[model samples]
Target: MYVRSQSDDIYGDVWTEEKAYCVEVEVHRVQDAEDLLFSPWREVSWTEKKREELRENLTLYKPSFEALSKVRVLLLGPVGAGKSSFINSIRSVLYRRVSLLPIIGSVSEGFTKKLKCYDIRAEKGGQPTALTLCDAMGFGDSEGTGMTLHDTLAVIKGHVPEGHKFQSEASINFNTPGYRQSPAMEDTVHCAVFVLDACKVLSYSENLEKKLKKLHRMISDLGIPHVVLLTHVDQVCHAVQEDVQYVYTSRIVQERMQKAAELVGLPLSFVYPIKNYASEVSVNCNTDILLLSAVNQILQAIDDASEDYPSAPQEAETKR
Candidate 1:
């Protein structure tokens, strides 16, 4: 039998007994595993000052061209992907309170049924910012379950109007009520955001995959810039759940973000991992920072896409 003790060679073997046997053992420090970090895969400032800076930037933002009044962003995704919740979160951050203007679903399906447009403000009763978030019915994984492709395309083309309830079995056309036969440049979507649950990125169904692929192609053909938001990121990594500041330092979260980017066929830079204000009663500095960062990137993308925005009917006629 041999005994172990603290020594200069903690990793050295212990020798004992008449047979002169040596048992090799290695010592490991607890701090070694605790100190393991991914070297901050992404850089983000988690301070109230940064949050206010982002808020000011968004408040002062405007469309690149004069024809457009506001940057219209369309939110699209599968059921329970937090599309509505994301809108509410943004409002909550901007208002510095818990805003639930958009209905969030509690079940496995989407809660938003109509094409609704939300005008955000930097403060309550303040002037509307130069941005609008349009929410639509989530895409389902089965036939005739969620928003139809035709309706989605029509919405992108600026044909559908606000408050138009989506019919999974029917597609929007010129004959539809309140259809904008000639939608202005400000009515169309400048950017398309595809929200996905970070935890379910790998388990997407075949039907959902096909629908996403088709939507991606269609949106690309329309020349509208698209991005993917991987929500519920706190649920994906324990480290991030404990402290959102560790989002970039957690390897698990980074891997999930990479997988989400791959699933949506977008570049790594085009994908953002966000934690919606779920179960939280008040605003959080870190959460607000992450959400604002995503919004800032989205607005930047919209400005980039605005360079190629289709000319308005009047502008086209005038130019000709």
Candidate 2:
């Protein structure tokens, strides 16, 4: 029997007949065991510098043609999917503080009743982002309760003006006030984002899915770019709920993204997982990174679409 010393390495010490038979051996491990409950945290290649670079890229984004000054992305989703909350999330990052604008909260029905366009401005009062986010009323479970197909088409064609209230009784017509008789590329939607709740993905209503499919077909016919924003990611995946950095490694999160792609008929790359500022009163870096990543992809798609504009050739030369 031997006395334990403070300088002794408990795991490295070997026992003999003369010493205490507390046989100990050091085991060198190359990697950790796989966690069945949660995925291990993996480092993302993008750093704060990369995020800032993307933000600067967006700030200086220019359309191939001079007719358009900004890329407009229209947000479409059912009530409670956090469309307004998503807008607030992005604004929070840009302002470097919590933003409660666009007035988002829980309710029996959608709170936004008008076609509102939001612009992002730098915290230090520099040039605003070249992207415009258009927020429309949430789609309802029943007919004549929320945004109608006619209203969506009007907006897609750049006919619906900012602040035009949606009338459940009927659709906007040619005689509607503030209607643009001849809408230009700048006034039209460059990309469409369908916001969905990751928690409700496995249990999405058939009616809502059908409506989304129909809208997808219409948007496809117009050759407009579209994507899906899978929100509430934190509520779905346990690992992500614990720490959002594990989002990319979690199998559950990957499955939800796959489901979103299947539902919207979009590629997996076009589906983004995001967590909005629903219950949080302050801004968070993890949340901001997710929102900005989605925004950056949408901006790239908008830029691609702008390059293929049929009228760009003549319009570009005419301007010169």
Candidate 3:
């Protein structure tokens, strides 16, 4: 909330006798809906041409069959970590909001509110396989203790098998039989997109590192390369002289961040950061670009998903 005095509102006219010099600059109040999901408001002379041009080059993500069909990403995070919201953000990114309605009563909203997958091809669109970006139930260890960890894990696991490498003792359960899904309104989350709130309290919370490490180990063993989404970074990095790129100053924050990364184990590289809101316009953030800093990392994983396809691959003509 920035305040301006009445006098400051009016600009000084510098000896304007030739032409009437009246250039008005105003501040208008707008809501989160009006503002682009990942855009920061800035000042500019109102010109229709400029507006249209800006829209053309904008890298906005709107949910649409076109974009959705091209890739499949699974949203994974601790409970209340904004998994659903991020899924919505993806819809926004691909410009397919209208087409992406939560198929009413399809997934039993009261029991399991899942958006039906979009088959870009069926609608005279491109691909045959519909893209599935899953929003997995959060693994927050239950804000409620009455709920035992085992039952919660059962639901959270949601068809994602416990790979043989990690939980060797427990039988593998909760796997969506690889590809070729059933016709009965199925939503399979391929390739988990795990979220970590950048603003969450850092420092010692015993076993957090261990839990995160286990999660990472599981991800690696599952043979699914993942995208690490570190969100709400603006709240953590705003006040400091250090930029969002350097939010790891505090040793405590860094340690926790490291733990999150380590979870993915060796071979995987990099963590991505995003400022969740466009309340303020700054070079450090882009309100119109949900996690722009992390987009490259995400696309990399998406492109790599070809490796995980369940179908047998062509034997690259074995030359004698």
Candidate 4:
């Protein structure tokens, strides 16, 4: 059952033939649970004579000029927990179509958001994408420099317990290519977003858990694709913790953030609750539900890395 209809505007389809997806997927358990069987209004193949030209083109697609740019996102947080106001609220809400994307890497004029990177491109063909928004200067608000904790224990000793070190690894090279001087921080980071601030841990009664296990061992080497962006969540759902008891310190910081994502294995990762584009009379510059839950967690990471994004089994209208 598939009914087709679109009246113009897939948002400048970029080059026309249209194709932009970025689903990496490696939960092994659950952070998404197949996002309700994939639902972005599903259906986007269009071929039967363009189904009468896709109902005239279909509002030129607009998820705020969309740009997951193929998952390379590294928006680690701590400093003011806003990350340059969520990259200036996605370029002032798509202003200049994501600041005319050549790779959005030049927002910090002074306040340390250095080593900038947005570099995203692809609509009709696809290839150029970087997306490195490392606001790690205030590493957990202490102002450290780059990835610390001995660079996350030299990449978690080559992924702990992943097959007993693959039979001794012969010598210890592990695809070495000049490590990380600036080859763009040794790339390959699909998603490590963790910007939680929920009112500074809802006043912390006792849920820091050794500072979230030292920021989860300094970003758990992106283990199991961590993605917790719980910014403010509009003051944790419009404030009412047992009539102001403060919901038992936000439920012990959500059971120590779900036991630090199950001791870094990941039975739960992708959490969303954001609010803060800006303008709540700037006490410290807030706006929350975690900035629209970090804009719906990067549009669900561009709809789980879209491959033209569609898969509800098939039901545009029961396909006529």
Candidate 5:
């Protein structure tokens, strides 16, 4: 929308030089897709009643996989993209209190260094629920940093045992003491969640994008379901910052959703824009609804994938 002018040195001499016209930059404007809208910046359709219903549904549900005991979801993203924060946010909602189980802090060189897994339980000191989240080291711009392909495959195939420390210098081998030689269906990852910051959706570095695309192809070849979580929506959009419910209606969020979908080669429906509990002391209904909704969809994907798993029986239903 604006023009920039500059001059280049024609006759160059340190003391005296003549300038010539250089290239002018202009017409570089970014615009959101034009879509007809009836409402102007209002709360999302998800109401308090709906939030309560979803909370109850999520808390009481159990996986129907007769063979597998829990559905495993993998979390992957770059440094400081809020992967650990997302898990903590989900725990806060399910526990109905402030839970900081996963230690989250500033990403100087990626906070997590080992493979970790958490069991989502119904209540405090109760049995584990259907969902299980596994987190790994964050990816970095430079090579030989973060997780390598070998390590990623190890986790996806369920060979990399929980609490396996990631070594940037070398990948884990079968001879490693704690490596799981034979991983069961329950141990393998069922759904892959690519967590990304909404503020950087359109500005991801080239190196990061290449790594993501490479991982995407490997995940697709396995026929595993993929979902994208666009976090930190409040930082990008002002309206969403004021009220979490306005995320759906904000143009900025919608654009980020579209961009994230294209970046990860997923459909719009699979891309979820959510706000994690960054500094909140208590649980918010709207935030809980958004986070729980994403988890609900992931559980559904796990259920769908379980139908074709060889270990599962034909009647993969929980006998109440």
Candidate 6:
């Protein structure tokens, strides 16, 4: 008992009961598409000037504590969440070129297997910046895959040595080769970033959700500042795909970002949407600006956490 509208002619008069229902749903969806493009939920400057400001800020950033020469940041997330790609994007923005120092894997595979830290430089062959990005294997939903909980904790504590390959069944311990029994303060992670796929936020499996929650609790106990980088935003909303600046305004993207925050047990402000350079031939200003903004926020978070440390020269000098 269905009456066809003028738009229903697109089906070519061969509509069955199921087809009729689908067509009706499609009609309503198309009619309401405009509603999904909400007003600017978050304000972000999408201009070249803002881009320059962010870039310069990151380039000139220095740790508040003089004892530490560089601030270490650890990237953590589920498999194929663009952790390596995000690093490359940051490097590209800082270096002003398409830099691919970190090896990237397919959407379902993890390419980074070892615990390695990368020193970012503002220019090629120039002095490294004050920021060090540490890359590690992605976390898996199952017990015997990806990185183990112990290994993650060890890395945060600065005990795991560089170039240490992650083991599926075991974690690096005191007897492990090249392990740092007493790591310096500068070696420890000042910030932890959890990169997640925007499209998969709502679709995460039960096991994956449980794993993330557990990790969140452990990281929280350490009192380290953490944030979530919601990646692959372009794939989630059409408006964002057409224009990267439309990320915060798109209702779908905002909702997904909120869900991502809840998934990681962090505040909405801590969840940032980023689009890594996946298949681009060259860098774009909009993309660079977003990446720089995320890095700027991370540095701010690191500074906020450093405020609690003792200011005495003895403790600072010894820790360094």
Compare the candidates by TM-score and give the number of the best one. Answer: 1
lDDT per residue (tens digit) for residues 69-122 in model 4 = 233444654446565556554443323122332322333322443334453332
lDDT of 6 by residue, 219-243 (tens): 7667678899999999988877877
Two-way lDDT contest, 2 vs 3, winner: 2
Candidate 2 minimal-lDDT segment of 10 residues = 30-39
Worst 10 residues of 5 by lDDT: 311-320
Q: What overall lDDT goes with each candidate model?
A: 0.83, 0.77, 0.40, 0.38, 0.78, 0.83
The positional error of residue 16 in candidate 4, measured at the CA in angstroms, is 71
- Model 3 misplacement above 4 A: 1-70, 93-131, 142-189, 201-208, 239-259, 263-268, 278-285, 290-293, 305-320
Off by over 4 Å in 5: 1-44, 312-320
Clashing pairs in 2: none
TM-score of 5: 0.82
Better of 2 and 6 by lDDT: 6
**What is candidate 2's local distance difference test score?**
0.77
Candidate 3 per-residue lDDT, tens place, 222-303, comes to: 4545667766655544322233333333333344445556554433245655444223322222232334334445655644
TM-score of 1: 0.86
Q: Candidate 2 regions off by >4 Å?
A: 1-43, 312-320
List the pairs of residues colliding in candidate 5: none
lDDT of 4: 0.38
Q: Judged by lDDT against the true structure, how good is candidate 1? A: 0.83
Model 6 poorest 10 in a row by lDDT: 19-28
Residue-level lDDT for 137 in candidate 1: 91
Clashes of each: 0, 0, 21, 36, 0, 0
